[model samples]
Target chain A: MIEFLNSIQNSLIYKNFFLVLSGLDNTILLLLISLPVGFVLALLFALGRVSKIALLSRTIASYIFVIRGTPLLVQIYLIYFGLGSVKFIRESFLWYALKEPFWCGVIALTINTVAYGAEIFRGGIQSIEKSQVESGLSLGFGKFLLLRKIILPIALRKVLPSYGNELILMVKATSLVSLTTYMEMTGIARKIMAKTFAPVEAFIAAGILYLFLNFLMVQFVKYLEWKYNPHLRLNN
Target chain B: MFKFDKLVFGDAGWGDEFLIATLMTLLVSILSMGLGLFLAIITVWAKLIQNKITRFIANFYTTVIRGVPELLVIYLIFFGGNAVVMSIAKVFGYNKYIELNALTIATIAIAVISATYSSEVLRASYLTISKGQIEAARALGMNKFSIFFKVISPQVIRHALPGIGNVWQITLKDTSLISVTGLVEIMRQSRISSNVEHSPLTFLITAAILYLCLTTISSRVFKTLELNYSKGFST
Candidate 1:
């Protein structure tokens, strides 16, 4: 049984298991670091979109437009190889972080997801009934305070489900970092495939990892939905 | 700060290459999107079918395709496809390399991903249809094929337009990943131009702008289609 299990074709998984698992560290790091930063930025953008200032809202809207319109891959290349090549940026203090391919990827992923998440948040914010805002206004709450206290709480909760999809998207998107030579899951998988000459099996392993990650994210979203909105919960 | 010296037409510039690449991106995206919509309908049908195996396959297809990254999907189709072709040729005793075209592989990859997403949209739109409509169709003695053509499809289009529009935008942007397979799309064109001009930022910015134009215009078309399809439906 052991001999049968140790066949040449079957050795692919056990052989490079640790090498591939190391890649997950980068992938998880990308997800962990970028997501919080993206959430804050997405919220700010969403607020700016709803703000009364025409110039501010318009600027934020265009920023979101540009981000959404471009491919995440192109955005990564623009930041890593494109912006990273600039003389001024290279000379600046920002070069410390920009010099790393992984950081470039995080920057791209954060910006891309912020555009998408901001849209989802904007939809959530806009869906808030006028009566709620008017009540806050009538209660003498300042605009910023109301937004910080009430609007954000409700809007963020309302959009949690939609935002969950964005989370899964970001998780999958971390795979693109591999293109920048970041040793994420996809990158490691690619190397293994080349060495083993078994592209399908390599992809299957990576694909399974991604699916597992996304499945966890989906469950996380469901838990959030259940936790945050208790009324929607089913009681035994 | 960004140079446009390499953007102008003639021997001095890559303006022609950029134009051709943009067209290629559009062509590939359109081809994949059309095929994806067809596949999505089939997937939706499979999911809706009562057969256990068909439903499981359809569900698995959507779930796995959605869960995995586009890069992986593209790589698998590109390399695995070549491997399959080579193995088949070996089986035929030819003993030679047989590779699939990059364009075909890229299109298939994007088509597959888009189909899963669009299938959900299509399925949701179909399910939104009230049970009464189908019951009425049956009462009218219409067969299954006739019922779908005469009843379900028109309503599905009306409800599915906005979602389909979103899928189109995603599909259009996904064509950018095909550049990795050397499909000569906008992203690859920018890479080549940037290398030649030694100004990656300018060419990339130009590429971003072209994509912006495509996205904005297609969105407008979809908005119009949504309006047209929704006509006579009570808001």
Candidate 2:
């Protein structure tokens, strides 16, 4: 075991593994920024879908459908190359953000996650029993008060598991930003592969880093689930 | 300034190329989903077994595969897979670079990822099958295999179809990643065309449309199956 550790330490890929792991800084940044922005956008989309106005609801529904049906890779490329190719966009204030791979990735991911997150939110809100709403109203709860006190809390708890799944999916999805030439986890692996021609070693190291990150995220989400939903506890 | 004529099928058009790539995407997605279903059955079986070692192995497989990104898995299979095969062959005195076509690697990689999710779905469906039903099948002198096939499997399929449909949608989108492996799928074809034509928006929008078509058609098919299976019973 000591010899194996020494061998690994002596290898070029292992020596450079920390440099490659540094690419996950962008991955972490993407997650932190996109999740909250996506969540707010998702709330709007979900509300629009469930709103009384037919035009607003239909427009949001179609937008969700388009976003949901497409792949995130295509979406990223479209925003990066497609929008970046436009003359007006290049000249516009948005050029600074759209031209950079990092912001482009964040935008594309946020848009894609909004579609999915909205659907999950809509499902959770809809799943609430009608009697619950009626009871809240009978207790003289106003629309805003009812949404704040009864609806959002229950809906949030119900959607936590699926939302957690979406968060994990977003983390995985950030790997694609490497293709945009951003030095994320997968990007660094590609760089090492290009230099060392040791795709196996470099990719294994990268995969381990990703697995560790995801494991931590999953455990954190599990802790949140435990804390939020006491009714799900086993005889506690 | 967009040229609609270039999108038409002809000597001066990319319509034929797009159509061919669309077919390739469909073929890969269908093949992966089929293979994934087979793997899911085995995985769910392993998970269900009442053995400590088997359960641990199953958990490790699903957790690691699910935790990592699909792109890394594909790259690992494409690179590490060949190295493993070559090293194994070396013991037999056959030393050569064993090359796997992108289609095979992509199919296997996507199937492996899909199987993890599908196994979870299948396990959940299996759990929903009442224990009394299995006991009753045994009470009728049914063999284990017969009970599984004739009694339990159909209901499991009925319960698992929607979940399987969701997995298929994911698989369909995931085949785009195979473009990195040089597969001539829709995404790759669009990339080539856009690079050549200098019309990234046009080709990508076309690819997105092709994807929307595939998803729309498959969702319809799944809905039909769901209706057919639940014909007599009301949800």
Give the number of the best model, judged by lDDT: 2
Q: Chain B TM-score, candidate 1?
A: 0.93
lDDT of 2 by residue, A132-200 (tens): 999999999999999889888898899988998998999999999888998899999988888888888
Among the candidates, what TM-score does chain A have in each?
A: 0.93, 0.96
The TM-scores of all predictions, comma-separated, are 0.94, 0.96
Provide the clash count, candidate 2: 0
Tens digits of per-residue lDDT, candidate 2, B104-190, equal 888998999999999999999999999999999999999999999999999999999899899999999999998999999999999
Worst 10 residues of 2 chain A by lDDT: A12-21
Best-fitting candidate, scored by TM-score: 2
Look at candidate 1 and give me any clashing residue pairs: none
Span of ten consecutive residues with least summed lDDT in model 1 chain A:
A8-17
**Cα-lDDT of candidate 1:** 0.90
Residue-level error in angstroms, candidate 1, position B131: 2.5
Q: What is the C-alpha lDDT of each candidate?
A: 0.90, 0.91
Displacement of residue B40 (Cα, Å) in model 1 is 1.1
lDDT for B170 in candidate 1 is 94
